[model samples]
Target: MSFKSRTLLFVICLFVVSNKLVATPKVKTIPIFNIQVDSLIEQQSIRNDMTQLELLVLYNDALKEKKPADSVNIFKKLAILNADLGQPEDALIYTEKYIKNTLDFSILNSEAYNVIRGSEAHKELSENYMLQIDWISFIFLYVALIGFFFTVIINFSKKANRCAKLFISGFVGVHSLFILEFVLYISNIQYRLPHTYLIAALTALLYGPFLYLYFKSVTYNFKFRTIDLLHFLPTLILIVYLFPMYSLSSNDKIEIMLEINNSYNINRYVIFISKVVSLFIYAILIGKFHYSRRKEEDSIKGKKPVNRWKKTIYAIHVIYLVSYIIYGLPVSGLMLSFPYFINYIQVSIMSVMVIYLAYMAYVQPEIFKSYSVGTSENTIPPLEKYQKSGLTNALSEELKGNLIRLFVEDKVFKENNINLEELSKRLNTTRHNTSQIINEHFNINFFELINKFRIQEAIRILKEDIHGSLNIIDIAYEVGYNNKVTFNKAFKKETSLTPSEFINMQIKKGLYK
Candidate 1:
């Protein structure tokens, strides 16, 4: 199809899909809704003469009227509405409040309205969702720093001071993301509290380039220049944005706040511009890094595995950048089809990729080893076995423990059941170190850690069940196998039993339950 034709079709799809939202009648909040919904909404407020369902409409009506602080009221109403609504797939999906379960993406997806307690409560939806910045977001805010400080300790202990400082800057950059989220949530025109224009613009200034540096550092071995001070250039510009709000009457402050908010939209234009700039910066680095290695390979003539892993690491970085663009760019509301896109800006998804990159960077440091421009593998020694482990943490104890956890214990990358990442999230430790420490202590690698769980799950299913109505395929998937054929081969190799034999033997032995 032609590009114009494809673009036309996409536009049509957006209209078609959005009709349900735009055209649907605003159902009466109480008459059509039930006592259960009323009870649900009632929890948010003690003054419940009007049913909670009534409040949903009140908030929406208020928002339509541009009622100040109506959104804050809506969020209060939603906190109660959410319980009766069950899972908040559609509601929270568009809402700025990122209350989502990371491990189980499906739990909050595709939820249709189910009725109970009589009146058909018809999804008590929000056209403008509650984007309240509360203590909750601050909790995730520290993630960047937590990852950062640990990187510092890792580098400092290794005595790589330059890399440690670079990492600390990157960590500060990452920290600003939460800061941005917090500022937006608080300053959302919907709530209209005393608008902290100072906080809003200054935090935004701090966030953008920090993110740019973080990505560049991981992608290229680019050293921070003395001119790297330019990243803080925007925060310095915020003095102008804050000047208009001072010494205003409450009414005057509202006018000033509106001007600030309007100006903020212009500020959004700045973000889109920065986003494009950041994208170009990343691409240039990716290109420079890619061909430089190819040239080096031509000069030296080494077997490719040494360089091959490095290439894979670069490829993953591209995938991550693409995924970020997929979710992050659209969430900016710049594109025409923005709302139609599936948002994957969840911290968990990003965390998965970040964890993977860190793992690959550590496991295969040739990618990160920072050769001179145009230099190649022809000159450098193949990454040593110890070198692979050492890149993550060079000490023998660190290497042994990491390999054990990565290969033998299988925690971080496990697809199903218990895992290192899951355990870390449960325990709240950084993922890189979990692998590093586990690898150091146990002397296993990541794959072994995960596959062991898969193999064990398969065995338990066979031994514990007598009435095995589900087949080998079922057991394999139940244990998180992507396919049964692989599971059967692994099961046979590991436990001396093909799945069918294992199930049959279990039946004869009466072990199935």
Candidate 2:
């Protein structure tokens, strides 16, 4: 064959083989990325290293190619990823998007809208994405609204003092920002630049001091030093640099995000050093607190109150450490586009510490005193005087005062002939009223009070050297009790034993030693 004939024949053979080997693209199906991206939810199907994100990438590619089998997994993964990163409101939006995709897919299954919708998977498989936004919105609205009101009520409490009030204000502040972000997204009036690391950096920087303050509050009785505010210096500068002119467009936003990420590059290294330093500081504090508290506790006779705040402080400290560690990973460098949930969790922990500190500082100053064992007695005085009054709680003040005065101050039990009627008459009241007062106010009958005082008189007699030889009956009669039986019963009831048993037990226990 000539050169032209041979070349043409080779080309024809190659084209024929290509046609035979390549199967026709099967009947079009929904692309995985479209399903995953649109699926947009937290589902059982995709997890583990957030592998679902990979599926989402695939889904988006498939959708771009107009692949058909409906899937909403991408949005689901994003939602979960956002939540894992500690952005619930962001997660909520992603979930809503996933739901919308499901709700729009098919309405054949009424179960999707039902209250008892089975597993989350069932709901996705059955519905389209459209109906979900409203449902999710309502639920998110309900949660966000409740969170808002609780925030407001917490903010308004009278006992919540100025610093605490500020903390509560910030407590509501973060959630409010979340609400604003959600509202803006839902309204589509604004947009957050995707994969922007600046937000993550700003979050860490902005909340670091707040976190530190929170740490100080629960962990230490914190008094702010000038340096405490300095932790936020990076964020403050970042914010000031955020002139509207600088952020005039998305490019500006991206530029800012890039800058912020770069700052994290700088500060995270510092944060690492700071964390290492913090760990050492924490170790020192632990050792000091342990040593100091142990010495203090030994001076008193009780187990020390654990430096309970240390646990909370340690948690934040660990978070600081973790943030530094995360910054070290290559994935972390890329993923700084969004702060991890750990970042947000650290922020929340800090906020809680702040709120807790505020409570300790202002809302409940008693917390400050709580660490003081000496002050505990002053917090709630014993009711001994009231207990000794002997008048019923139900008695009128005048009657009670008179009763306590006549019976207690004057040692009326010394009069063997003292009777309830006589005492009632002296107080200018009926016997029944006096009886009721004694029963209610003193938690004892009148006779019981008299017997108690008589027992005390016997104790006085026994203490005197001359009366040591007196038998139970002799002691009883001398103390104004008519019979030994009455004295024994009264003695046992008052001192948990008979007179003979009390003296003998006390002697055996070495009180007499």
In terms of TM-score, the best-performing candidate is: 1
| Model 2 residue 438 CA deviation in Å | 23
Off by over 4 Å in 1: 1-152, 159-161, 164-225, 228-266, 297-317, 320-333, 337-341, 345-349, 361-513
- lDDT tens digits, residue span 121-239, model 1: 22322212223445534444444344444444444433223443354345343433434444344325323443433343344344335444543443335677889877676556554
How high is each candidate's TM-score?
Answer: 0.37, 0.33
**How accurate locally is residue 37 in candidate 1, as Cα lDDT from 0 to 100?**
33
**Models, CA RMSD each:** 25.2, 15.5
lDDT of 1: 0.47
lDDT of candidate 2 at residue 455, scale 0 to 100: 81
Worst 10 residues of 2 by lDDT: 297-306
Could you give me the TM-score of model 2 versus the true structure?
Answer: 0.33
Off by more than 4 A, model 2: 1-155, 164-203, 206-208, 211-246, 254-310, 313-324, 327-513
Error of 1 at 206 (Å): 8.7
